[model samples]
Target: MNSADGAAVVVGVDGSEPATRAVLLAAREAVRRNRPLRVVHGFIWPLLGVPVAAPAGAPPHAGLRHQAEQLVADAVNAAQAQESGLRITGEIIDGEAAAVLIGESPTAALIVLGDRGLGGFASLVIGSVALQVTAYAECPVLVARGTARDTGPVVAGVDGSALSRAAVEFAAEAASCRGAPLRVVYARPGGRAAQAGEEERLLAESVAGIAERWPDVPITREAVHARPVAALTEASRDAQLVVVGRQGRGELSGLLLGSVSQGILHRSACPVAVVRTPG
Candidate 1:
């Protein structure tokens, strides 16, 4: 999904290492977009039928509420440290983590989440919270993973679909903002020499307006004879950000995320941004 104009960059934190990384990345994104940063902690204790207040005679900060507040406080502090003079705020919302983030997504320019968090299964490549938010959020969802690098090209996987073109638009803006080169990759699994011309033409059409829109950003188009997931994952090896459409051509209408998009999320070597045309 696309971001609303002038909206803040929202990030979810849970006191995990991955969440901490997400905070810093969100801060960077906010600065790049010239928008404010909002750090949100989804507090689930109140919704679990547990007492939110501390027991009588107990320490003032003994309640789960206090801990939740502290988590947001610490995350806000960390984000501010990462980006001094940046407009940053924090909140403790009573709801499920994924639900809270999705609620914030409607008014946010971007939603940033950790690939995995404390609530996630250790063996899974991506957390349930992250996946849920990515699937349902109203704005684009960025999952921070692997090494955080700010010095690589911005990669976009396009297939000439409207959603793929939308992803290309997002990638162009990201590349322009970072002053990095933009690589638009189109992967065609069929290795037919006779169809090479058609594939090349479609690739060009996918990124048709990107150059005119972001004249300063260098654009490269590549047509690969490989699976989309494999090609994009390999490109992510040296990319600062990888953008893909949540649902693309040939995907089932009921699926929130296309197979190639999900594969990229699970295997990309850099941060992954899932985009779709906002309603």
Candidate 2:
């Protein structure tokens, strides 16, 4: 597929089982969006002691490059098997995995990565690459996690912040595409009835006009006097996907990620999609 035909859905693969899962999920998203799937494998052969250059006319780090190429090819094949007739392409680029994926964000509709990579420890809930990409990517980043067994509403954390508004927009479209209902939630600390009223208004304002844009998506709003992390994490227990802004009001605006986003990332029961507010 040509890059000119809208932004492609990009997935990073590293020859890990989790990466294969990401490929399948990304392939389905590409098919749903009617966009191409670009499967990329970031390779750093020199870091592994592979020579960057060989004698004239000879391939440089041919063995390492070939392995990277094979990884991309396998991911492509798996994507194809997941969704026949999917427009797909594969590339092996030399760079840090997070850097390569983040660089692709400018031309990508969504960046999908495995919750854990080849080097990630089993104790780690999210790999470093996934966390870095999700925190910095210009476009939305979806961390493929947990089994795709639940068929529940698309849950979104809404606080009326600019970033949360972006997350609501993204969640609305995602729900519309999947024909799933949307659950917009706003969590406030308990203690004051006056604050509860204010949060209710915020929740309402955050989701205003969503039904107009996504008329087919049924939306349900919740304003609870609970901790943001605890509320959203519990909502994720049965959600098909949990959507959150890259940053929120809890931290300074200059921060790349807020406490809520980080909390959900570490504890969400379903896949998490982090949407950044557009510049």
Candidate 3:
């Protein structure tokens, strides 16, 4: 979402199919925010014990660094070509991909990353780097896939946590910008009986409550009894944007995201925005 005074956007590029989508999204956001953009590529030679720099006559490190550099250049070029006056900088950092991205996220208004990547185990976790970055980035992180980048309503997960309140605010602003309805989700479980008497809050009430706190915008809510991550993902599968707060609640160790946020990052069909506000 574009902050009123504009904000910088940072994106992680690793020459993956999903990365192109992230770059495009980040560029668009940068333009909208009217702020600087950075196309970051974190590099570390594969563990094959292979050289990474060019030999005397051979290509540098068998062209590893060269290829990666070219890839980053192309990504940055593509992103910058679309928007004039965009301060798009490309950074080639060495070390673990996820770690560096997290390192740079401190000053970033938001960190943009792909839903998945080329390397690492697949099917469940998306990829290690993407997963780790979303979980620990200093600023809010938006994880996008190529397909989900095009656009939808700004959907946010609300769990009554203070963090979720921040997410709702962010989602409301995004939905307003896109002129889309806001979807608020709270999940518990189904097919179970509770106490004899209860004054349950309607799912829609949550969304309505948040909407009432902000500027007028269409709002919707859902309360289902299922896994928080599962329900949120399934409900927002067709949504354009889904925002959730990082679960790093009280008394946590140095830098940690909640399990639900981490789980949704890997499984949500739509691009997920994990918002983390400083304590």
Candidate 4:
């Protein structure tokens, strides 16, 4: 993690693969946004509730702190190596990891984490840290799993209804800032869900219309098969940020979030941005 300057992206490091992935993702984001990255490494004397007594000749908490400092130093070196221009700094915090991370999560721009976390079973489908960050962070939380997105378009799910526009706007702006292409995917069921290419074509036109508002940004368009939830998930499989319209439907529209956004929040590999526009 780098020192904080203005708005920054925060990542938690624990010397695990997930933690390292989080570090890499955060570094790339910081470099792209031109903002400093804040790396926070926390250590607790207790190992999952078991306390260790200090060895005969060691000072109290000395061993823990030393190990923690070394761990954080290694994480910092790896991050700086990946992004040469990245400004980085780190510290060893004392306390519970999840608590310290949330307490220290950067409120400036975004928070990035690994899909799974440093703690818990390695074979599990999800980790406690990812779930915790998403539920509590003030700023939108991004969890990168497996391969992190370096250069790819953003895939967002939306309908032609009222709430759809909000997701589109967010996706467009995000793509513009990253200078990556924007792919707006409207997933509709077969048969009566949408009239062939009509809905998809309309969606493309709508995204194009929004792009006019930002003369400098580049946005692309698309539509897909299957239900909105499944289609969106498939589309976002290779995307950076999976943006989705919440509480909306092609049948009726208002200030409501649909299950599509909710479902993706839990399963997507990349981070999800759930946007809801008022009726």
Clashes of each: 1, 0, 9, 6
Residue 66 accuracy (lDDT) in model 4: 63
Candidate numbers, best TM-score first, in rank order: 1, 2, 3, 4
Candidate 4 TM-score to native? 0.74
In candidate 1, what are the lDDT values of residues 141-235, reduced to their tens digit? 89997766989899999987887888899899999889999999998886556353887798889988778889999999998889999999999
Lowest lDDT sum, 10 consecutive residues, model 3, at 197-206
- Give the winner by lDDT: 1
TM-score of each: 0.94, 0.90, 0.82, 0.74
Between candidates 3 and 4, name the one with more favorable lDDT: 3
lDDT of 2 by residue, 1-279 (tens): 233568899999999988999999899888877789999988877667776455567665456566677789889999998899998999988888998898999879999999998994888888999988988898899988775533799999987888899999999998887889999999887875654368678988899889998999999999877999999989988898999997522255666878898889888888889999877
Which segments of candidate 4 are over 4 A away from where they belong? 1-5, 44-56, 59-62, 159-170, 195-209, 245-279
Per-model C-alpha lDDT, please?
0.88, 0.86, 0.75, 0.69
- Tens digit of per-residue lDDT, candidate 3, span 72-166: 99998889787767888888888778988989887788889887778766664567777787777778888884246445677888776677877
lDDT of 4 by residue, 111-196 (tens): 77776766668576557766555545555456665456757778767677655676777677777768777787776687766655
The parts of candidate 1 lying over 4 Å away from their true place are 1-5, 190-196, 248-252
